[model samples]
Target: MLDATLKTQLKAYLEKVVQPIEIVASLNDSAKSQELQALLQDIVQLSDKITLREQGDAKRAPSFTIQRAGTDIGVTFAGIPMGHEFTSLVLALLQVGGHTIKLDDAVIEQIRNLDGDYEFETFVSLSCHNCPEVVQALNAMSVINPRIKVTTIDGGVFPKEVEDRQIMAVPMMFLNGEHFGQGRTSVEEILSRLDSNAGVRAAAELSKKDVFDVLVIGGGPAGAASSIYAARKGIRTGVLAERFGGQVLDTLAIENFISVKETEGPKFAAALEEHVKAYDVDIMNLQRAVKLIPGKIAEVHTASGAVLKAKTVILSTGARWREINVPGEKEYRNHGVAYCPHCDGPLFKGKRVAVVGGGNSGVEAAIDLAGVVQHVTLIEYGTELRADAVLQRKLRSLPNVQIIMSAQTTEINGDGQKVTSLSYTDRSSGAAHKIDLEGVFVQIGLVPNTEWLKGTIALSRFGEIEIDARGQTSVPGVFAAGDCTTVPFKQIVIAVGAGATAALSAFDHLIRSGDEEPQTTETKQAVAV
Candidate 1:
């Protein structure tokens, strides 16, 4: 299961273990069980503090638990934790064996003080890049509080449970057999959901923060660059984001990021965060800016009732996946309608699926799904595909791929629990058609996450923040960058450059408009709405 190089790395990581641990495997006479046994044996050979035991009768066969020798301070993996989850397995091993987690001390205390028993089950795909974060978070919480138990199940290994639960998305989490959340979630997010007073406490803390010289919204490539550049200027810089990494976290592969031959999205996002953390930037994650009021000291209001003031504000809220907005689409989201093909494609293996859009993302999704799914129907509203010629050619070469041009997706049909088919119309002939499928992957495009900024700042007809070459918006002392702004070519490299320009422009504005009076109570109330 693990190669020589991996074994060497595992051995090295195991050296950090300060306490004895046990790997208890529950297996049957199957090839997968045998493979898991071999893997566990190899792990035990590397560390004298580790031991493995097998039990034949268990609820989930071929599953295993990594626990501290006499305690339940560990996590469970129901499938082979390979691919993107390999790191998660290593972190779990070390954490269970008395290696301290790198989370904030306050966060560790919060987990330890939680009162109730929480059993978390997270369903994930091996190829899913977003699953590791959620798994690792819950695993860490479990280690902090034995009352919290985490079980990570591979959707590919246990198809029955996935279908029974009507799961069509990766990293779908359940609490005590009830749906908790879907997609990327952090430990703080989970805690906030569980604790009623968490939001109020966070809001109070944020309200007491001192005014920042430069406050950046969003945590994508653009916001990261802006924060780093501003912090380098020796000013008080802070970044507030609903979540760091933005759309980059959803991206699967990148080959055109300049100087780097190839890298994954999560990896690139991690590097960006690490680079920014090396500076003096104060990062506030899991916070969304609901309103922005411009003045001498601009006020950014959050959904948690926290109003943050800053000398200059940088808007880099970035963009989100564009929804089809058709009938039954919202009703069936995560029930069979998905936006990420890389994460959810394997769930529909040996089943039919549809990809909506004609652009590079849709064509690429079709091409990728052809290798895993039984069939793929590519639906496009345009007359022709807008992908690169090479990608179009590759998509055309696939035997299981079907291309439908000039077709508008009208509705996503579901059986109340999962998608059963999709409805569309022929744009040229005005003929309605429906294709039976198990999943629908929407890859139309992206819409700027500027809905909250509407009426507060000047936005284009398409809802993008209007900005000049200097990245300055219509509002003074306010700047915008990245996909949320009026920048051409929404690429990571372009966003990074735009972010730097915006930061410098902001500093220049601050120098020119020195000693301006703060907003009065009446002035603040006028725009507070």
Candidate 2:
């Protein structure tokens, strides 16, 4: 067993790369196995093509398409597979390469008694930051049955291939190469897939996850609202999220947060978190649901090795920042350029900054940075800014926020250390200019948090989940709300409303079935209704 100090250090060391065991082994024999250690590094660098890149490819996928790599052999991770997560990745690779996690006799028995091997694959993206668990749970399922190969690919780095295969979300999976699934799933349901062999090919397209008594997929405003509704309704509710508060956590201010009218994003998110915590719902943090198997009882497999069974499932795993799709743009993200300007823009205070794209996000970021930086250059690839007229006027009004129209950012210029500047071409002028910048905010657009839903749920052409007015997907039991879902608006209030609708609908479903119990007076009084 590792000592406490060693364990802590090990945990910190894991933040850097995959293969923690190998790192430990190399450090142990660094002096004696110097050549071998060097060889390992080379192998990690050269053979780490978990996903393929066409000769002309530029950026990674919406994130890595942690699918297509195939059961372990071509294992590709959509996100940074580090931290405690490395162990899960290793185990998955070992199993795919032919190995298994030593399960207790009881667990192993469950595996043996399992009717068959239900293969699963989870695609993920590194920027997702919440997708690691989806990768782990699928691996655990694979270990139960080696024949049940669970392939994971990086989605950010392989857009075309995953798109060609029709990948719409991360933590996506395909069972038996035909019945595909997404979001998250429990081992029991995974086994059911093997036993039933239902959606092998039908999974290639998107569809909603299996419904349950309660399905709260997001931990954001909408998700919290739904969870509160279901729990108060006496519905056995469960929630899964990439993180709580969804995109709300990325916002710097909540000038419009209810009751208080104003609050910081994280602060409001924490408040919402506390409220969610006040309920009986099962909430998992830093945990992601990778696949959802539609069946009698929906199974949810968390990256943290916990399997939850719910009568209904809700999806609110919100949106992530859009990218520049440049070659090194990804490799150096957070290293210099960033997404949540609130979290990272301050790092470049007093430094020259450039905001790419002309969308509201980009323009708004430029305006926000004008006061903090010496120079703020807002570059728009289109002929005009797509941001709202107010935002365009505000961006142009900032003396420091320079607007460049008819421009396309070609590459993010950087040194081996950090970002140095950006290179873009003025399409109309046929001129290219390089601006020295300490940071580049690529606000091209927002990619719906629906990539993982590709194979499992139906998605709108714009990449949002397709939900009815009641927030129901094509699948009966599953429901979605938030920026990830295909509702008309992407605002926080809209998402909250969607969550409420989903919860009420799911509650009606449970009551109609009579499988769920009725609510007590106290439970009824708990909700705002």
Candidate 3:
């Protein structure tokens, strides 16, 4: 149930609807449609301009179409609008009701000139924080062009469809019947993917090789810092990143970074990119590296079959949150199990939630959720919490937060649809316990993103790239930094410093090896790294 403040806000938003918006519900099962109908009725009651129309004899159990001005607008939601997806539904209604779509002039023209009929089907888990952005963007595009049919599916509700498509992650996009991509994607990127066959053919025909003086494998703080340092030396530097922000994008608030009192992760990432672009570094975003070939000139191959060559390579590919393997963990993801607390915490507002792990991340997530959720049960497998003293103290101060020690999570018990409870074993007493909750947030630890460097580079036992004091790897010209390397502590400031040191080391190597043009008698200025 929504609070009074949220209800007031929703009412205010609905009152701004310009054109009459109609909700066409295809009802096959009355039991399944009750919640959806109630939600629609509540929304319609807020504004006289909105109404709902039920259509019988539809095959779909719970599907709805939003129409305005007698046009379908090609927007549909296959499941009940709840969780993080509620924002998507609300934004779609506003966009069709006359909200100005914020897009580039070229992008708007491209949407207006769309060539063929494209059905944009977005499969998302309700708990995914990044899912709503993609869904809302496509929905707005649908309003811009009638040919772009947009359909949103709840991955948790329609597990059969997700399985048929072999979708392992949320925010998975599909054009027509072909799988487009997974994760958060921009509107421009989706438009480029409309003609998938032609795009692939064009990419294959233009097999070009790009050579750089120093190539950074990631685009996070470490990679951005390295590229900036290398570019300052007047050398050709480039960075290839999957999303250009790394793990920082998922973070909600960051106060540890020096000089800045407080900032959000996405904002900090954008600032990092702007600073890096201030130099002459070439940034390649949305490129996933699949393989690394070590040699005199190291070669990096992307998922798109593109090859990049560099005299020296810097590996800063960051880490990701590790998954706690247990029964029903993957099956009920986004239904009642979530990974990002800051992103999905609001969805479980006024509801009980469980947090796994006892480290800094786990304790921090518990503290963060304690303010939003009604109660938080933190389960730790270790004897005591491994969080910092300050974090532990803060967590103890929370009245609604409870921490369980030496508890090994055995299984995630769910009702085949959403998580109802979680089962764990007390290692000391050899007893099992289960807690009833609406959501579970896993915050065990981080896993390095160095799997592609298995045979090409020397790695530590934990799959981290082995680096020395100067950030140089075992290979002659190869270097590493950030969480992907054997860094003692994974922090933003430390990664940035590591990146700078690696770039300076690389420049020193190039100078000593006489790779750059020899200094002339007329110019005596030394090259700065």
lDDT of 1 by residue, 1-529 (tens): 6789999999999999999999999998888888889889999999999999889766787899998999868799998888899899999999999998998998899889999999999999999988998999999999999999899999988899888888889899999888899898889999999887899999999999999989999999999999988876666899999989889988989899899899999889989999999988889888999999999999999999999999999999999999999998999999889999989988999999999998999999999999999999999999999999999999999999999999999999988888999999999999999999999999999999999988999999999999999999999999999999889789999999999999888877877787334446875554232
- Where is the poorest 10-residue window by lDDT in model 2? 20-29
Q: Which candidate number has the best TM-score?
A: 1
**Candidate models: Cα lDDT each:** 0.91, 0.62, 0.83
Write one digit per residue (lDDT tens) for candidate 3, span 193-308: 76455345434532464678899999999999999988878888999897787898777679999999998786688799889988888887767888988777888888877788
Model 3 — which ten-residue stretch has the worst lDDT? 520-529
What is the descending TM-score order?
A: 1, 3, 2
196: Cα error in model 2, Å: 35
For residues 1-529, what per-residue lDDT tens digits would candidate 2 score against the true structure?
2346645654443334332222112123223234323423433343343223322131322222222233333233433344334555545545443344454465455565666555555655543333454566566655454545555555433445554564433345666676365543444444444544323322321123333477677788888888987877755576666567777765655665456787666567768878877878766444566666765687766544445667777777777777778766876665566665543454455779888878877877888778767898888878888999998887777777788899878888777657788888889988989898877877776777666667787888888888888888877778888788877667777777888888888877777777666767776776546
Identify the superior model by lDDT, candidate 2 or candidate 3: 3
Candidate number of the best lDDT: 1
Off by over 4 Å in 2: 1-212, 429-431, 517-528
**Candidate 1 at residue 349, lDDT?**
92
| lDDT score at residue 101, model 3, on the 0-100 scale | 75
